[model samples]
Target: MSANARTVHPLGERLGKVLPPLMVLGVVVAVWWAVVVKTESAIFPTPWQVVTGAMELVEDGTLWEHIRASLFRVGAGFGLAVLVGIPLGLWMGWVGAAYRTFNPIFQMLRPISPIAWIPVAILWFGVGEVSPIFLIFISSVFPLIVQTTSGVHTIDRRYLRAAANFGVPRSVLFRQVVIPAVLPEIIVGMRIGIGVAWLVVVAAEMIALRSGLGYLIMDSRNAGNRYDLVIAAMIIIGTIGLMLDGITRLLEKLKTVRWRYVR
Candidate 1:
């Protein structure tokens, strides 16, 4: 293709990605507004009402506080999950005995809903920030451990065999090859973990804490049916969740990990 064509093509691709979503969002909002108007919703909020509600929160300074609290909790919990899970997963993946011992326990715990642990979290950590952080860690860490372990299992045997043939030290082989090879999978796990963590933190905040977006929704509801604020909180939660996912996706573009992300 010509240079101009190449330039135009990428611009087209970007627009292709962005425009459809924008169009769909517009249609959804239009329909939402129309429905609210027709139904004369005493409780349901129109798009503009949600916007106004958001602005009200912004004006009162509570919006940033709630957003900051939620982000901080997610960051802390997800950080802990990464630190604990990745190393544990790598060890379990490499050592047969470790895998045999730990796999059953994690598998048993994995299927339980994080929400179900709210009582236990509250009991263990009390109704404080630690409760939600602990829940987020619990919710996020499992997927990372599972994914990283699976990644190690699936690493090409030839890589290991070739490293062995070359007399590469066990430590060097693990550091240079195993870690790099497993990074893509680690990123995948992180993506899943972060999403779950965000969800868990919000839920924990709603039930146990006073300061996150989740609490904003619950609080808005109780304060004379402020459904607009409720919807605004919901939208903020969703938008931030998407942004977190996108940030995780950017890690896939790292040179060492990019090879595994085949189209």
Candidate 2:
């Protein structure tokens, strides 16, 4: 091979990763613009109309307020889920009796949709931030518990046996051996949980409360038939969710857990 063929350009590598998505996005926008122009429909917005709608929200400062409220609910709910679920899952996995006792209850509740809890949440928390927060929590917690417990159960028995043979204390064994082995799975669970939390918060805000992107979409459509704003809200929600997942994926690159990510 030529010397040039043996070397890779950083800029070219980055462009290789970036160009395909941009090309697809361009195609999508072109098709959307064509459809709007051909149909002459007032309800279905062109790409430019959506941009204009987003700019309007930015100018009024309402966009940031809605984003902040939605993010706060997701963060609070998902944080609570991580704190509670990890320890409970670890205990259940480490103890056979605890696993049998709690596994059935979790299985029963896990299948229930977060949207189904909206009415009860409103009744319990009475139509405020707490109601939506509760809904996000329920949506995220089950997946975390399931994933964490499974991770612990799947750890190699040899590791535990080695630790025991070395006369390691129970707490030390768990802290050093068990936790490091499961860290990757915990990060995966958190990624899934946060996505679910984001989804639930939107629906919860639509039903139980106001002042989020969900509310913006609903209220804009109901009050003014503003399809542009509704679409803008959807785009914002998707973008934020992608960013959240990207943050969690960074954990896979950390040196401590990076081995688990090796193909």
- Candidate 2 lDDT by residue in tens digits, 75-141: 9999899999999888888889999999999999999999999999988989998988889889999
Quote the positional error of residue 215 for candidate 1 in Å: 0.5
- TM accuracy, model 2: 0.97
Assess the local accuracy of residue 38 in candidate 1 as a C-alpha lDDT between 0 and 100. Answer: 100
Which RMSD values do the candidates have, in order? 1.5, 1.2
**Winning model by lDDT:** 1
Query: What local distance difference test score does each model get?
Result: 0.95, 0.92
User: Residue by residue across 136-204, what tens digits does model 1's lDDT show?
Assistant: 999999999999999999999998999899999999999999999899999999999999999998888
Runs in model 2 deviating more than 4 A are 2-4
Clashing pairs in 1: none
- Per-candidate TM-score against the hidden true structure: 0.96, 0.97
lDDT value for candidate 1? 0.95
